[model samples]
Target: MIKGYKTQIMDYYEKIRYHERKALQERKDNIKREHPEILDLENEIGRLSIKLSMDILRHGNADDVVSKTREAITDLRVQKAELLVAYGYGQDYLSMHYQCSKCNDTGYIGTKRCSCFDRYLVKLYYKSSELAESIKTNNFNTFNLDFYSPRSDGSEKFSPRDNIEQILSYIKNDYIPNFKNHSVNMLFYGDPGTGKTFMTQCIAKELLDKGFLVIYKTSDELNKDLRTITFDNDKALEESLINCDLLIIDDLGAEQITDFSVTNFFTFLNKKLIKNKKMLISTNLLLSDLTKSYTERITSRLFGNFRLQKFYTEDIRIQKKSLRQNRFSEKTILNQ
Candidate 1:
């Protein structure tokens, strides 16, 4: 990941430098056509500066000679600015433009990363993770409460919609803001199509927009990558899984279980929990299934460290499909 990030930053710097050079060349072209003397003055200033440096190196009186040369360079710069202003251009028109003046198109300000560099990394991460596309369409604003059942059917007191609304409110108002200081992990378990995955996406999108690094992966994909690490010592995927601000493992029970898979899962989970990194896991497994599939220690850590939310509702996909079919049938009858 760091290698990829460095490569990307270098590409960005090259692109910016190219633009700066092109812009400066264009400005120089205009000056050559309309105000050729400005270029000549700039050339003279450069020559004088070089001569002053040579003189200082050749045993001239350092303080007095350097002060006189500095004054001459300052005066020449003032003339250049005056000429530029006379031609209705900014004084710094020929200066190289930078997206970040603090870093001058570099990714760092001294030893620290510039804010522009950080933002660039965040953007690159979002794009590489495929979250950029999903985040646009799956944020809190687009989430529909109508998809969840509004009324509880006998067994439950609150409706699925009500529960979801409460959860959303808590996440938006409480969880995301304090996430940097407090590590909170969540587990959403329910039947398929109960909006668990959608909720997970929603949270991921929100956290990502808030400038937190979020990684979302299905259990099958995650398992395959983890298992591959056993054969190859590549630790990039594992490092990202453990280190991102929010890790969302969707459809956790969908993976083919094996001893190695189970051990890696436990290790990954424990490492994140120990480091106080947040995670959100969505699975179709019941509490009983969770206990049966994993060891006591694994299940214990899950139950102890994660906030478990059960999504109790009918299959929303089926409901939506039926609703569409009914609408189509009604339209057909009306046409007849």
Candidate 2:
């Protein structure tokens, strides 16, 4: 699309230049033939500006020439406005005289990037959304901390809501200055439906906004992909997974642990650690289960590298289901 736009922009620029040149010559010709005493300051300003620019280009020290060029351009602009009014054209006619007024149709702005270059960056970011989609589109704004209950009911004493809030605050503040400069690695371990995945997704969303590139993938999907390829594709996925700006491997212990997968997972983890790339992982299994499922090296690296947060809760799905049934029964009786 950008290439196509570049071609179109060039064509549009050529057309606009042709029209401006024709207008200028027609103005000069009319003055020479008809309005000889009208004092054609516009053409004189144009010639002075050309001379100034040439002088700057040749000398390579353009302080005076640049100042004079600015004055000449300003004078010609004022003259053009007066001429347009005299000839019954409006102020809007100036827009059609140049395709890009900022760069004056040269396609570059001063010494830095142009608006077109910025647009190309925006396009590149939009195209690079395969990983970003998992992060940006799912953020803390979409996370409902309210869903977490403050108490663990009459059974045992634990506070999931308080735990979640602490986790949330830690993630938000930790990323402010330090994580922005140096990335942080984390591990989320817990029972199923206890908000491990939820918290990891929230972090992914936050770090992405802080300008860290993040890739969120389940261990199951990653292992499957690795098995399908032999060499090149395998290397590419390995590199991306290990060395991305941030990586969140969700559902860690869920994949069937074959020898190839166990080796690959450890290798990926070790490489990320070596590079200082941050890794956040979530697992349904405890440390003991993890050790049994994966190798001792993988577990050791995980414990050594990541700030571990273990989630504890009765599955919220079950609680919500019970609540719904009781609510419906009450509503039916009230209606009766």
Candidate 3:
């Protein structure tokens, strides 16, 4: 992954260089066609620059010659800019352009990586995660409130749509803005196909777009990696899980439970809370079920730290499938 990231950064630099060269050549060609004398002036500047370099190399202590050459080069640059302006071009027309002037199209400023480079790495990490393609379509804008029923059931006062809307509003207004300062943990627990995972993905997409480092993994995948730490001595996945700005674990109850999983889950939750890192977990199990499966200590940490939101919606996937079938039937009838 590191190698791939490096290759991607280098590719971006190459593209910048390629476009810069192309634009410079086009400008030079236009100048040569319209004002041929400008080319002669450019050549004179280039020759003087070469001469200055040679003179400095030959007589290192020749302060007079070096000073004269420096003044001559400065004069040539002023002349070049004036000529460009006189020719109906910008004064900086011949200057080398860069996409990012801070790093001059390179991914680093000295030894540290630029913010742009960090964003690229975050994008790469998002792409490398599971269900990455869904993130493009599953953000807040694409989330449909229509899929959730607004009518209250006999047992519940608030409808699914109202509950979900409140949750979304809270996330947008409070959670995301204060994410860096607060360790806001969320637990989405409900039935399958009730948009639990969808909501988590929407949160992840929003945070990722805000340039936060979000590491998303399924509970099964996370457990498999955590298990490897004991046998294979692999710490890469563990480090990422704990250190990411936002760690999202999907389908929390679907993973195989074990002694190690229970112990590590407690440790992971405690550590993330201590570090003030945010976490979002989606699961199909209820609070009681979770308590029965995991220990009271594990459940206590989760209930104590995380804001639990129970999804009370019908199966949206089934509704979508039905809608698709209806569309297909309508198209078939139209064709007939």
When superposed on Cα atoms, how far off is each prediction in RMSD?
3.2, 8.5, 4.7
Q: Determine which window of 10 residues in candidate 2 has minimal summed lDDT.
A: 1-10
**1-336 per-residue lDDT for model 3 (tens digits):** 322456776797889889998999898898899887877778888998888888889887467797798888888788888888987899878777887888888889999878777677787887786657888888888999998888878666789889888988898899988887887789999889989888888888888888888888899977876677657765655666677788889998889998889887777778788887778999999899999999999899899989998887878889999999999999999999
The sequence of per-residue lDDT tens digits that candidate 1 reaches over residues 149-260 is 8888767778888888888888888888788887788999989988888788888877777787787888998898777666676576677677777888889889998888
All candidates: TM-score: 0.84, 0.60, 0.74
Q: Clashing pairs in model 3?
A: none
TM-score of 2: 0.60
Candidate 3 lDDT for residue 259? 85
Per-residue alpha-carbon lDDT of model 2 for 3-91, expressed as tens digits? 23344445655666788878766755655665443346656665777887787887665577677677777877787777667877564
The whole-model C-alpha lDDT of candidate 1 against the native structure comes to 0.83
Candidate 2: lDDT of 51? 81
lDDT of each: 0.83, 0.69, 0.83
Where model 1 places Cα greater than 4 Å from the true spot, the runs are 1-9, 55-62, 109-113, 128-137, 177-182, 228-231, 235-239
Of models 2 and 3, which has the larger TM-score?
Answer: 3
Residue 69 lDDT (model 2): 73
